[model samples]
Target: MGFKKHLSSLKSYEAGKPIELVIRDYGIRQKDIIKLASNENPLGTSKKVIKAIKKEAKNSYRYPDDSMFELKKSLAKKYKVDSKNIIIGQGSDQIIELLVQATCGSEDKILTSSLTFAMYEIYASHNQAKVLKTKDGVHNADQFIEIYQKSKPNLVFLCIPNNPLGDCLDRSEVYRILDSISSDTIVALDCAYGEFAAYKDKNKEIKPKEIIKKYKNCIYLGTFSKLYGLGGLRIGYGIADSNFIEMLSKLRAPFNITNLSLKAAIIALEDSTFLKNSLKNNFKEMKVYEDFAKSKNIDFIESYTNFITFMLPKSIDSSSLCEYLLKQGVIIRDLKSYGINAIRITIGLREQNKTTIKLIDKYLKR
Candidate 1:
């Protein structure tokens, strides 16, 4: 077995467990399992997008438009960017892998926050790039610049309103970090939660084209998985200068996105009604988790994203709390793998959110 020595140690990215798996494992009825683990749109995929997907499914025999011309044009219009600046991927996961494959030599390094997305490290490991990560839970641009200066990594990643923890830093802070870092380094900002982030009073807006044009080395990543309720479709993209996009395009697989996913993404993008409602629900329901945490004296990191990660009281073990919720047929994410003893729950529908909190409280009382 002459597999690359580094590949053996790389762990696959663990996704939030789906409801079907949870139901089967725990012998719970399907409807009874309230899955608040993944930061998915609890309102569900748009009817318009579903219709588009079904309509396009008949054309699956033919390969996807290899150029993905129309979809890119739609995204370009949506972001006010030129089509050449956009590169769609099967998911943001592929874009990250493509970045690592394109830039990292065996001896180069990839850097990110210690507990941000894991795919950055997983992909870098394949190239045998030394993955350097800062220990801060939140993104502090100055701190990242300090680490980057010492390490001089070839690729850098920042997950906005970062995964699991949901902490965020605004564009001004991002600009500071970009200015301090070596201009030659490729900085990838994973804005997977940007839509949820767009409406905030502060730290809400980022001009990706402007950022890329000024920095020249930045790739801004976006996804339809969260707000668009298209996780099952597997569509995501990156925006950067045309030159950078052209370089990365060489490494991307042909027909990287499926036909149905592409069509649905276009429909989802055009459906302003669905997008508005998803954002509205996320902003309103997220506060309930915050208020409930305070009332229960449960410690939590403040979040701008659709999920809230809160810690159980010291008297209660994290696993026990999770298990209690599991028995009650409520599924959520545990952050032990992220090295934090907390639970991250998506802002589900009002009833689901109510049930999750009530059962958690009942478990505490027991």
Candidate 2:
């Protein structure tokens, strides 16, 4: 009646509180609550995606395309990569799990920053691979290269515009790490927030396809969750070398992605107007939050993504501050989970952003 020791040792991912949970805990009405905790799109899914989902709703009785042919083909055309190089998943989360299963073993190790995305450590531990925590929070390329030269891991998970901190390693730093790592090591780049990152940067844009083509071991992971606003559909994909794609494809469960999700993702990609609007709204809100933080004399990390992380005064505990915010019907993330004395607030709709800032100002004054 016992599970593996590693299973017992694994820490579960702590997701944000649901709106219902916040309402129940604070005895507040659901209508008053605004959740900015999970880094999800506040605008929700695009109209085209919603239409596609509804149109395909009647086909629920039929099995989905296991190969995700059309989705893969669309992605291939969009990224100018070969269809053979693409592998779709329930989400980029599942793709991360699949990559661990496909490439790692009990004796293998997975390298990643200490406070990066929690999934990297979770999946690595689930696969019984040694989770090698890196020293830097930013995943500096020189630090990674120094460690890889010594430990030589089987897989590496790098999150650009790193979660919680919202700090991105420069492209030059990334290139350095790529050049230093062993050719045998598989590098997985989690670009879940890549679209938002690109939208935030005024001077630089990262073309993931270029890196994918240049390095055989490199794999780029993208999700419809952020910019396209398809978190509910749970659709994502990986772009890599054909051999890696084929290997990962074999391990992918049949009909792992729903027909509705695939249809929605196809339309989401084509909705250029929605994409542009989402970026515009996010950028505008980001500046508003930055100015508000400055006026309040609060220190915050500059972000190249939709979410902003800021520190509470030393006199206030983040957990208590989050609790207070919850009672006020604003649910922002408590960075205690990420081992920081900070909180992350996602860029929401203008009204929501304004309300959240007012609430924070009120809380700080009291």
Candidate 3:
């Protein structure tokens, strides 16, 4: 038997290893390992969400609501959007795949910045769409406008506070891309880390909701994986024009989300206290990272998200440095996969952050 040529050319996504797997591989105790690879919320899921999950656990025999009506309603209320404009997915990654499946064809091109989220490229390839990589590690709106004018891509993926780099484009830049693109082209804004982005000057406000409302061709993708600490649950959603939402609904599998996950998400959404605390802690830890990098005279990009990406000194090999950190029970992301000589480390608990810095200092000194 033979597969399609496109399928053969597709590269599988390499996710971060589980703590248990890392422990087994290194023959180290689980207690000693600290994983900061995936940019997860170090505070973990809210207590209310935990309780909701536990309460719903006994009802595992029942299938989830295919419409996800309750969850959709909660989101609609939170974002001030209509329920008809929302569609749920297993995660933001799944939403990206569905967008590609619905809109893109084998010869269609998807435009994205270089070194953006890897999943966008993977999903585009899976759907047989040609991907056009931008020149810079950062996604500049002007570059996107130029590319769109020349190539006229069917779809575009923009990661605000982009992965691997942790930098976000200003609202004016995003608006320029949105305004310049042809109406026939679709724009997908991946705001998975939106909640972590602080008020930077006057232009960096969270604007995806407003953008979705303004542009019929625009879709806003969000995930509970980062802010709500629900990565294990694999729950995320998209907000778009009602017509696009309807199309996505038809393409989505029934019961795509689990009952427990729905319940947890509902509770998580209502946990204002937890959300506040998580954001506060994230800012505090991020400042610590910033101060540490400054003190060490290290070059790092200022992050608007939970993760920080810093260049490795010319004397040190990034992969080897990562390995050294791993041996010391500190796990962080190596950006070699993204064609960069940098590493991304997630902001964790205060004690964990201190320990990670200490370990990295020890390794760098030697």
What CA RMSD would you report for each candidate? 1.3, 1.5, 1.3
Q: Per-residue lDDT of 1-366 in model 3, one digit per residue for the tens?
A: 587766876788877757987788898899889999998999998988998898899999999988889999999999998889899999898899888898887889999998898888888888778899788887788888889899999999989878879888887888888999877899998989877764433465555568777898999889999989999999999999999888778888888999998998898999999988988888888888888888888889878888898887788678888899888788999888777788899999999999999988887889
lDDT of 1: 0.87
lDDT of 1 at 333: 85
Stretches of candidate 1 off by over 4 Å are: none
Clash tally, candidates in order = 0, 0, 0
TM-score of 1: 0.97
At residue 272, give the lDDT of candidate 3: 92
Candidate 2 off by > 4 Å: 202-204
Cα TM-score per model = 0.97, 0.96, 0.97
Give the per-residue lDDT digits (tens) of candidate 2, residues 85-161. Answer: 99998889999999999888899998898878898888888888898877877667777887888999999988987
Q: What's the distance in Å from true for residue 3, model 3?
A: 1.6
Judged by whole-model lDDT over C-alpha atoms, candidate 3 comes out at 0.86
Pairs with steric clashes in candidate 2: none
